[model samples]
Target: MAISFYKYQGTGNDFVMVDNRKLAFPASDESFIKRLCDRRIGIGADGLILLQDHADYDFEMVYFNADGRLGSMCGNGARCTVRFARALGVIEDVACFLAADGEHQASVERDLIQLKMNEVKGVEQIGEDYFLNTGSPHYIRFVDDVENLDVYEEGRAIRYNDRFKAEGTNVNFVQRLSDSEVFVRTYERGVEDETLSCGTGVTAAALVAGMLGMQSPIKVKTLGGNLEVAFEQVDEGFKSIYLIGPAKQVFTGSVSL
Candidate 1:
């Protein structure tokens, strides 16, 4: 069978998108999904996203990592899915969708998407580094020179370390440029590599910045592009967190299954 798919990207983190509202795709085939995300002979993406029908929301976002395993909530994927929903006339400018992490709200304007993330109750301090979950688990480390760092090597070390090796964690190195700006690079767990950018990782970094006394609406610089994270600090947690960035459809094509 042949399946039609859409390619979308948000800050260089690309995904293969499928409109599976009618349940046409074989979502249970992990190896097939892995092959579809292969760089050499497949669609070549960091992940795959399925936009399916949801009774309670605009749509349901089903995400899988490049490795073909069911992944946790993906912020960038959710943003791109929101745009896809709009293109499919499933939603207008505003939308509410169901994801692995639960319900999320979003607004789309042209190519820019503003996605609301879940509230974080607390941040755990592991030595000098910080760990938090912004719809996904992330380890945030403050660094001096982020641009010159070997993200792959260092991030791999931390990700595979004794403490986090079992259930992998996304690693992020953050360099604060100013009180309101930061540069971040991430090693995502599912992809198991240093991606151009990571939405959940960026959100984790921004919330850590808030904990360090930086204000809200932090500007984030990544290898792919720029993104913004805005939030309101509440009692011992954060609320109204939004990850703002651009998600664009690259192309559409049909592939044999």
Candidate 2:
């Protein structure tokens, strides 16, 4: 069957989107979904997203990793879905939806998207790295120079290490460039390699640094582009955390799967 799909990217993290409002698409076949995300012979993407109907929100975002397993909330994927929703008239300029993590809010203004991520409690410092879940689980560590570091080598060690072996976590290497600016490199688990960008990874990285005494409105530079995370910190947790960057439509087409 030919599946109508739309491709979109938030920074460099790309996704193949399908409007599955009728829920007619097969959601149970892992191999089928996995093959659809294959770069060599399929409509390549970091993930696949289904825009389904929601009872109380604009729409529902169902995310599947490249491995064909349903995953926790994906920030870049969410932004792409929001933009897709707007293009489909599910929303006009603003939208809210329920993800695996919980409720999320986003707005589209002039092609750029500002997504409000879930509140992060804080980062737990274990040894040298900080652990936190910003919609998705991430391990944030600061290094001297992030650009030169071997992200795939070092990140794989920490991700596959015995401590996080059951379900590996995404790893991020961050280097603070200034009080409010930092460079980030990530080793994503689903893609299982270093992509040009990662939204949840950056969100976790910024929150971890902010909790550790860095300032808010943090600027994060990724291989794809720059993203800004702004928030207010309180004794309870980090609130009003906003992930802002460009979420653009790459192309739209139908693929036979």
Candidate 3:
């Protein structure tokens, strides 16, 4: 069988995208998906995304890490999926879709995408770091020299630590650049290494930084590119959270399986 796929990247976090609305792709074939995301021999992406039919929303986003396991709500992946949906004519400028984290809303203009994230009830402060779930678990720590930090070594330590070993977690090493900007590096759990960028990780980083007195619409710089996070803090929790970035199609091809 020859499966047609599209490649997309948001802030350097790339994905192999499939329009599976007709349910043609085999969702249970873990090895096949893993091979497609393998950097050495396959499509070479950080993850894979499926745009499927949804009864209540514009579409359903099924995401998988490079390891072939179902992953949590991937911020960048979702943004890419939304753009994919738009290219497929499933949506116009604004859209609402279903993901592993639940329903999410998004808007696309040109190559830029703005996604509405879930509300965060609280942020846990562990030692000097902060732990939060912005549709995905993230461990955030502020550092001084982010440019030279060993993200893989340091992030792996906390990601696989006994405290978070059960489910594991994405790790972010951040350095404050200004009141509204910061530099972030991430080690994603499912990817199991340092990635060029991480959407959920940055969202958590920005939120934690905001809680620490940074302003809304925080700008985050990553190795891949830059992203912005904006939110409104309510009395009970945080709301109107948005993750903004660029998601562009890299290429498209057919792979024989």
Candidate 4:
């Protein structure tokens, strides 16, 4: 069978998107999904996203890592899925969608998407580093020089450490550029490599920065491009958190399954 797919990218976090509202895709085939995301042999994406029908929301986002496993809530993938939903006329400017983490609200203007993440109640400080879940687990380490760090090696160490080796976690290295701006690079677990960008990781880093007395509406610079995270610090945690960035369609094609 020939399946039509769209390629989308937010920053440099790219995904292979399929409109699976009809449930035609074989989602249970992990090897096929892995092949689809293989850079050398397939569609070459950081992950794959399925847009399916949802009874209570605009749509349902089903995400899979490049390794073909069902992944946690992927922020950039969600943003790209929202853009795909808009392209399919499933939503207008505003949308509410169901993801792995639960319900989420977002708005899209042209290619820019502002996605509302889940409320975080706490941040765990592991030494000087921090750990948090912003729809996804992330380990945030404030560094001195982000541009020259060995993200793959250092992030792999923490991600595969004794405490986090089982389920795994995304690792982020952040360097504060100013009071409101920081540079970040991430090593995502599912992808098992240093990706150009990571939305959930960026959000986690921003919240940690806020806890360290930086500010809200933090500007983030990544290897792929730039993104912004805005939130309100509540008494218990953070609320009204928004991950703002641009998600654009790279191309569209049909491939045999």
Query: By lDDT, who's the top model here?
Result: 4
Task: Give the runs in model 1 whose Cα sits over 4 Å from its true position.
Answer: none
* Per-residue lDDT of model 3, residues 1-257, tens digit only: 99899999999999999999889888889999999999898999999999999899999999999999999999999999999998999999999999999999999977689999999998888999998999999999999999999999999999889999899999999999998999999999989999999999999999888888999999999999999999998776689999999999999999997
Clashes of 4: 0
> Candidate 4: what lDDT?
0.96
Q: How do all the candidates rank in terms of lDDT, highest first?
A: 4, 1, 3, 2
Give lDDT tens digits, candidate 4, residues 1-257: 99999999999999999999999999999999999999999999999999999899999999999999999999999999999999999999999999999999999977689999999998899999999999899999999999999999999999999999999999999999998999999999989999999999999999999998988899999999999999999988999999999999999999898
CA shift of 143, model 4, Å: 0.5
Tens-digit lDDT string for candidate 1 (23-109): 999999999999999999899999999999989988999999999999999988988999899999999999998999999999987
Query: Candidate 4's error at 139, in angstroms?
Result: 0.4
* Model 4 stretches with alpha carbons more than 4 Å out: none
- TM-score of candidate 4 against the unseen true structure: 0.99
Each model's total of backbone clashes: 0, 0, 0, 0
The whole-model lDDT of each prediction reads: 0.95, 0.89, 0.94, 0.96
